[model samples]
Target: MSEPKSYIQVLSPELLGRVFDAYAHKPDEEKHLIGLETTLFSSCESGFYANPVILSHVSKNWRNISLDRPTLWSTMIMVRPIASHIPKVENWLERSKTAPLTLQIMQTIPDDDTPIEPLREERTAVNTILEMLLKHIERWEAITFFLCIGFLPAFAEFPQGKLDQLKSATLNLATWSTHPQVVDRVFRAIHAAPELEFVSWCASFFQTGLPDHVPWQQLKRIELDVNDISEEPSSVGYVLDILSKCPQLTSAKFILGFCKTTTPKALNTPLNLPNLRSLALDEASSPNIAYVLQNLTLPSLHTLNLSLFSDEERSSANLFKAVGSLVGRSKSTLKYLGLDIDDEQLLKLLPFAKDVEVLRVGGAKTKKFTSLLTRNANNKISLEVLPKLEYLHLTYAQDAMRPHRISASTAALNRMVVFRTSQPPATPGLKKLKFISVGTAASSFQTAHITLILGTYSHLNLKSVRFEGN
Candidate 1:
């Protein structure tokens, strides 16, 4: 009898080719594929079967089809590249032909016990890899680098206008010392790229602040994360200055370290962002966060996220008031709001954003907020707070300082969900709640209770209900 045919041998070439293409572009949470040399490494946790390079070795027919598809080889992720992989990199680039390339060059972060110095051979390998990539600069569509500051000089050699196809770039430069001159030169090279629109710049603090030569007018999205370890933290005024230059930005995020105290003269006038739609500010003191909210006028803002790590209660009170005033002054119809604040502060800020459709909060105590959402003694939803809220996400904040603090009880959550979902369709200005996600301690909420809630609400046509345990 003839041997039985395997799955690969029985499938048609066209169907197999489509499968190969889909696997090549599938998103991986870990992005564990080391590079083009997939056979030399293995990720025991995620498995190597997801790598597209593995398909070529399955059979002769599969190899022929893989070689014929150029786009399948366009994306290359190099993690701690070495000299031995040079030939594989060349072969991969050659196979991509003229297709646009998406590259991610990363290095393993060293722990405290590990040496910070790069091995002599590793430096040679990195330099050679970058040199090869520069030869095809015109085909770069998106590139991300998580490397040391020493590599910034290599990018200064990029010819102007050679990055016409580049639309996105992420520079995560890290080192113990600052290099303002090198950083400035790199920014100058980036400014010459006319097609660049999205950028994420993360680095340690620089005394000179952000470069002024960037193509800010052409950018639509930007994220700046500056970790300040110096005696004087960067000022919010400097960040506002950068935003003033970007008139075309629709989304912006600023994650600064400790912020310097703001004086009345810091912001002489209110800055207007007529086109911005989304903004997020994180890790600043309460006063600094309030300072930012007080000086900005976002007429088109729809989504906002604010997080503070300050311990001053008075400043937090001021921050809440500032938020309410900003929303009221802009008269913008906010659709989404996220806050890492307490229940009282959240309640005070929600009234100004009554049109918000989604609300996310992180706090140790949310009983009061959930009660406000539940039907009152008259069996009616509150018209004054979040009348149009459709989705609610609550994250339990486990602070070591307040170990006895309790989160929203399971009973409170169930009642709130039932009340919001049971609202009559004829109710004016009130929308039925469709989704709820709760993240709390495992002991507080059990899987059986969640199952019971799902069984009870299944008839209400709710979209989804999720529970995550810590």
Candidate 2:
């Protein structure tokens, strides 16, 4: 008699194919099964899924299934491309057949005090990989580059309009190296792509300012970050000038460096963005973000996030004032608001965003804010303060050496929730609070405190109430 068939050998090809397909696309947490180890090309990053190369080595059946699935090899993320990666990259490209590719090439900057210098071998490896990828440029769907400035020349040779299938591109320089001409060529090549809609560029804005040849009219989303280590800061006028050209933008984020320049004179008419729905502005330690807010009219905006690192009272007050004026001028119905400001300023700004359904406050003293939400002796919540709010998240600043301070007492938080939910069902324009999260320093809130709060409110049917200590 023939030897007993093994369990794997008995499965039909159809079933094996389905199993391989599911295994290849499982979530990162679930991909740590017995046989899935780091192959030659697997990324150890948190979000990346398991590599298909390991499956191909499991058995002849598995190998055939994996090799036939082009999509299984389409996404390639190389943390730091090296000479050893060329063969595996070539293999992946061959297996991927004609499927579109999503590529992420990153080289993290060292955190130590040592000066940065790109190794010659690393540059050569990167150029080899680029040459291989450019051969299949028409199959590129999305690409991300977080590399040293030396690699910019490798991209200078990219042919214009060859990225016919590209939709998104992220180019971030991890060093202070500046090569404007190479940067311009890279931008021009990307701008010529017919289908590109999103672009994120992080670099030293003072040296390599916004490229003059971006496909601004076709871009739907854009994120610009000014390098933090640069000595010179970007001005508000320069940023506003860039925005004026992108009339089709629906989402925009600017992480501006320190800005010492005075606010440019207001546009004869505020720059109108009727289609923009989300806008975020952050400054390292400057109040100049107010100038950006002061100069724009976003009639379609529903989400706004403002973060200013300065702790000066004057800066906080001015920033909040500009926010309120912009809200009133736009008359846009805001559905989400995020602020990194003092509690007092937050109180002043909430009245302008009465339609806000989600509120996120970070690095704020929350005692007063929670009190404002609590019911008065008459058991009535103020109609002016986030009456439509459904979700609230508060994160407090913490120092490592000092003891944790409770920003909002458990009583205040519980009372705020109870009052917000106790409103009459027939109350017009009020939404029942559904979720609340309080993230604080370690030991600020105990596990029992969160359990008690949840147990007491079980009847209210709150979706989630979480207290996280860090």
Candidate 3:
């Protein structure tokens, strides 16, 4: 006997489509508020397919409705290359129609750590899938690919005219080892993307390959990870050359492995990035960063993130000096500052950022930081150190791991909040406070003190308080 369909399944196509559309557009509070990161789960996992895919398999009516909804299939997420799933990929493209697309392709390796070359069947399937996607390249709005370098040739084979609508792209190359011909071909293909606004290229490329193919002046956001560059000295030149070409870049982030300074002539040359609003420099202890900062003139910069990681003490001294010089050369127009330095270093630099309204501290304690927000003995806060700050974001957590310092930090935080709220006219109070605790105990925060502060500051328009635990 056949099972009868329920009332929900028997609804009209229009009504069903409306329901699904509403569900798709609903604000995902959990993802945003809770800081939920997107994870690439393997197909062997139970819940591989998301809502649209699962809905199509419900009944005949639902399947028809889902197929008709073009928006439902515009965003396709693939775990890896699977021969059997080619049919599904084809169906998604057919249903997507002419709508703009967002594709995320995660190329995962086998469980046995075997090379993908031996997997002929999977390789063939992947090639077929890539061809189909290339056929519809005009509809690519945002694309993220984590694929092997072997696929570079396949990408280069595609025609350039098809990438008219491409806007954002993230390419996580599997290997840094690539031939010059392949690199040039790949960059040439990317250069054809006229509307490309955001690009994240996390791989090593020869310095000479840049500024030739890519339209650097058209890009607004760029993130580069050049950890595999062979020569340390050439890395600085590579960054400077790219920066020189990108005058229209509004936001840029660099992840450098080796720390080396630029040449004297390079440092002497002044580069003006008028449109740059935000810049982040993440290096593994490089004095070169300081020299780079000293040479550039960023008139529009408002947000700066400097995350320099090194084992030895005093590695960040040169960086700090460079930053101070940069701030002095540029106007004190910064509104937001994010730092990953230790206590003493941050204290030394906060005075230069007096105009900063929002501050985000990562990988450091908030204990000494609270002093910056506090009023001195004369009941007057220093006008030269974060005096206009209204938003505070702490990326570190007070937990059992650091039992000795946790209580002190908590107390300092409490006092800072209390002092700021009470002396509003003399010192601007924080209007919003956010805490991000990743892989840590969320319960470590003092709920009683937070509640009391909220209750006390209810009249000061201090309503936004967020504690994000991921």
- Per-candidate TM-score against the hidden true structure: 0.78, 0.78, 0.74
TM-score for predicted model 3 compared with the true structure: 0.74
lDDT of each: 0.68, 0.71, 0.63
The predictions' CA RMSDs to the true structure, in order, are 5.7, 5.9, 6.8
Candidate 2 clash pair list: none
Residue 366 miss distance in model 3 (angstroms): 5.8
For residue 258, model 3's alpha carbon misses the true position, in angstroms, by 0.8
The CA-based lDDT of model 1 is what? 0.68
Per-residue lDDT over 210-296 for candidate 2, one digit per residue giving the tens place of the 0 to 100 score = 656778889989887654424576566766877888898899887765665466677787888989999987643435667778888
**For candidate 1, lDDT tens digit of each residue in 1-470?**
99999897788877777778777766443444432333222111122224457878987888898888877787776666677756666887898899998877765555556455543455567668778888998898888876652554455455666888888888666462456555555556666678888877666335445565678889989888645323466677767877998998899888754666663454667788888999998766667677788888898999998766533422544666887777877878789998765556667777667788998776544678778778543554365567788998776434542122335666787777887776565566677789887654322443554555456666665798866553
Per-residue lDDT of model 3, residues 167-233, tens digit only:
9887755353455555555556666788888876655353443335567879898887665433344
- Model 1, poorest ten-residue lDDT window? 39-48
Model 2 global lDDT (CA atoms, 0 to 1): 0.71
> Whole-model lDDT, candidate 3?
0.63
What is the alpha-carbon RMSD of candidate 1 to the true structure?
A: 5.7
